[model samples]
Target: MAAAIMNLVRVSDPDTIVLGGGVAGSANFVERIRSYLNPKTMRFVSSARS
Candidate 1:
């Protein structure tokens, strides 16, 4: 999942990611995602938004 999101962010290079619907309900899940993204991805992957 991190890899997939990385690929998208690398390809698209967006400032923010907006997650809608049921995917927005999990705050911990989003934090987990940010954790996987920020440091691991060369400190470029921004956190997602609901």
Candidate 2:
């Protein structure tokens, strides 16, 4: 999903990405993986939640 969370944010360059079980609690699915990421890899990467 969302290209495997952007390949684990390009190999764990993580500021904050905390998703939980059950398809990350459905709904919008974390804004559809923050609109499919890659706005320059989301510019230092703020929070993402489940």
Candidate 3:
């Protein structure tokens, strides 16, 4: 999954990424994602405040 995303980022060079919907419901899903993608880009999303 991370490898696929990394490939996309490398090809696209986007400025920002957004993670929304059900996957964002997981507690550490965003963090795990950020850890894999940084310090390459920034993410914009809401956290699970529960």
Candidate 4:
């Protein structure tokens, strides 16, 4: 799932990736997604919140 999101990020190259839905709102799930995505794709993420 993380990989898939990362792929989207790479292809799209958006300013930010907004994670909606209940699953994305979870702390652990967000962390898990970040784990695979950190230091490679998303260099700097401002925050999950606005």
**Backbone collision count in every prediction?**
0, 0, 0, 0
Candidate 4 off by > 4 Å: 44-50
- Over the stretch 1-50, how does candidate 4's per-residue lDDT look in tens digits? 78887788778877877888998879998888777876745665555542
Predictions in order: lDDT: 0.68, 0.73, 0.58, 0.74
Candidate 3 per-residue lDDT, tens place, 19-50, comes to 56898767688667656754534242232233
Give candidate 4's error at residue 45 in angstroms.
5.9
RMSD, candidate 3, Å: 5.6
The model with the greater TM-score, 3 or 4, is: 4
Q: Evaluate model 2: give its lDDT.
A: 0.73
Ranking of models by TM-score:
4, 1, 3, 2
* Residue-level lDDT for 34 in candidate 2: 73
Pairs of residues clashing in candidate 3:
none
Q: Could you tell me how far off, in angstroms, the CA of residue 2 lies in candidate 2 after the best superposition?
A: 8.8
- Which portions of model 2 miss their true places by more than 4 Å? 1-14, 25-35, 46-50
Q: What does candidate 2's lDDT look like per residue over 1-50, in tens digits? A: 77787888789877766778987888787677778887785666665554
Candidates in order, TM-scores: namely 0.60, 0.28, 0.52, 0.69
* True-structure RMSD, every candidate: 2.6, 9.2, 5.6, 2.5
Name the candidate, 1 or 3, with the larger TM-score value: 1
Cα displacement (angstroms), candidate 3, residue 21, comes to 0.6
Model 1 C-alpha lDDT per residue in residues 1-50, reported as the tens digit of each score: 56777888789987876665676568877777667765756477443344
